[model samples]
Target: MWVQRVIELTGWEPLGVSVDWAVVEGELGVPLPADYKELYEAFGGGVFSDSVYFLGRDEGVSFDFLAQWRVGLSVDQDGKFGDVSAVDPYAIYAPGGKGLVEWTPPNGPTSTSG
Candidate 1:
């Protein structure tokens, strides 16, 4: 429903892409949110309204979700991004721990995490 709303608002046709969730979750060391997975499946990777860039399963691309997540963690750990107060200091969400995870590209107004 939410994805449909996004489609309606953005006039984006769903790509209906398939992703290897097992591989993605395995690499991330945690299961991704169902809604996120659904969104990915519906839309894949691309920018929305030139503002929000949704990372997807595409490897080595600017919109690759997994690569962005790794880069986010690396940048946070290296203290390179600067002023990442929006995200937790160095925590990443896991089985019992709470932390932030990247779902969008970094820099500009396009990046986002949760």
Candidate 2:
């Protein structure tokens, strides 16, 4: 499975965290992909290889998916992107709206290996 591959590649152990997908989907106003749900359930949230960061259901934590989405929506709504007039405006994704949504931090990923 892809999750197993991820574990092999990143050497990350599965935490087997349980999540209420119905609640999460209700809040997000969208159904998450099955693979993504699987991944989150397995690993929770953490940095992988000090690079990829998985957003999980841990509320109030930095890697909390819903919290990050709210922050992204706020930024989009408040016109926080400075001096980017050329970029086309887009709405944050909602129940029936199609638009941009943040799946990770803007800083991209980093590597811990030196």
Candidate 3:
């Protein structure tokens, strides 16, 4: 609803392609929010107001956002501390970690771990 409102106001256009959730979730090891997938489906990827840059599933681009996120995970998992790890890197998601830790589902809410 809010996203649709923003789109209506800003004239943001969709990328016009269906997303592959299976591949995405399999690679990320998490289930994402439905609204986020809807937004991604409506708007492929790009920056907004020169402040927020949206990540898309475009694999051809060198600056793929999803690819970048994976890189961060790799760095953390490898324990190569560039200047202190921003994220645990080795931190496991809920059901494996401490308790119900919140996780960012790309552009969605921090889903409560079950």
Question: Highest lDDT among the candidates is held by which one?
Answer: 1
How would the candidate models be sorted by TM-score, starting from the highest? Answer: 2, 3, 1
lDDT of 3 by residue, 33-103 (tens): 77767777787776779867666577655436568777775666645534434355455456645633456
The TM-score of predicted model 1 comes to 0.56
What is the TM-score of each predicted model, taking all chains together?
0.56, 0.58, 0.57
Each prediction's Cα lDDT score?
0.73, 0.72, 0.65
Better of 1 and 2 by TM-score: 2
RMSD of each: 10.2, 12.6, 8.0
Model 2 agreement with the true structure over 53-110: per-residue lDDT tens digits: 7897896568888887777666656355442221247676777879665453234432
C-alpha positional error of residue 91 in candidate 1 after TM-score superposition, expressed in Å: 12
State residue 53's C-alpha deviation in candidate 3, in Å: 3.6
> lDDT per residue, candidate 1, 13-50, as tens digits?
88888898888878765667677888888878888799
Off by over 4 Å in 3: 49-51, 61-65, 79-114
The residue pairs in collision within model 2 are: none
* lDDT of residue 106 for candidate 3: 68
Regions more than 4 Å wrong, model 2 = 8-11, 49-51, 78-114
